[model samples]
Target: MKILIPFYSTYGHVYKMAEAIAEGVEKVEGVNAELRRIEEAIPEETLKEIGAFEAQKDFAHIPECNLDDLKEADGIIIGTPTRFGNIAGQVQNFLDTTGSLWMEGALIGKVGSVFVSTASQHGGQETTIRNLHTTLLHHGMIIVGLPYSFAGQGTIDEISGGSPYGATTIAGSDGSRMPSENELEGARFQGEHVAKIVAKMTV
Candidate 1:
């Protein structure tokens, strides 16, 4: 099965998590995975002035996601950094253009999963993921989440981001932090769970 991962990351944390998730999908035999990013909404001049553009350049090699990619995927995983308890505007804008897909139920019955990164532990990870879930559900996609079967979901010894909602990471206020191995484990589990489910459904 082919799984498409579409995401928007400002400081690379979400990208790292996406890589971990790709690794998990690869672990499952016969699952094909590809990474793509949403279109940038930020103006080039502003992005350069604020340093977010330079950071984006590091990931420029990744292809821009298009509606065709969404239409072609057997399974989809979305990753986005939180913006005030909501999905980033870039992700929102990308989804906004999928009206035709939603109208025809193009994504119906497909396995859809999400992962997120936030600036703080309570930086609206749940809300952001839930919002994405709401959108995917509208398209008639089956939602997949990072279940407690993953150790990171229940760990009391460390700060973590996994929940029944989805996998997550705390990127710190300045967006300087990368996802820890624990958080990446959560992302990996999310990927593997979605891959297995897609496998079963496709078979």
Candidate 2:
């Protein structure tokens, strides 16, 4: 079974979580995980001016996701940083291109999940995941999320981003914070959980 992890990250925060999710998916024997980057919507000059150009280099080697990638996967995990309580425009742009897929029901019954990064602890993490879910539901996908059994999402000792909606990490206002171990663990658990479900469905 194959699972595609398609994501857009201005900084490397969401990318790190994507890697952790891939790791978890790989732990499920017979499951293959693919990481694909969403095309950048910003101009090169603008990306340089905002420092996103440099930060994006870490994931530049990843392949850009294509519609065929979506069609072939048994499951999909989307990772996007929040943009004012919603998905980033780049992610929106990518999803917007799926009209053909929706018309043909190409993604029907496939497992769909999401992960995210935000500038603050309460920065619309749940809303962003739910907003993404709307698109998945329209495509007739089976939605999966980070279940409460992950346990790390309930910690009160530190400020972290995670919920029943999805896995998330707080990037801090200045974008210096990387995903903590707990947040990454949540991502891994979600990935593995989705892979397990997909495996059974495929069988």
Candidate 1, residue 203: how far the Cα is off, in Å: 0.8
Task: Give lDDT per model, in order.
Answer: 0.90, 0.96
Report model 2's TM-score to 2 decimal places: 0.99
lDDT of 2 at 92: 96
- TM-score per candidate, chains pooled: 0.97, 0.99
lDDT of 1: 0.90
Q: List runs of model 2 lying over 4 Å from the truth.
A: none
Q: Which digits, one per residue and each the tens of the lDDT, describe model 2 over residues 59-110?
A: 9999999999999999999999999999999999999999999999999999
lDDT of 1 by residue, 52-148 (tens): 8878887889999999999999999999999999999999999999999998889999999999999899999999999999999999999988887
Per lDDT, the best of the predicted structures is: 2
Model 2 per-residue lDDT at 164? 97
Which segments of model 1 are wrong by more than 4 Å? none
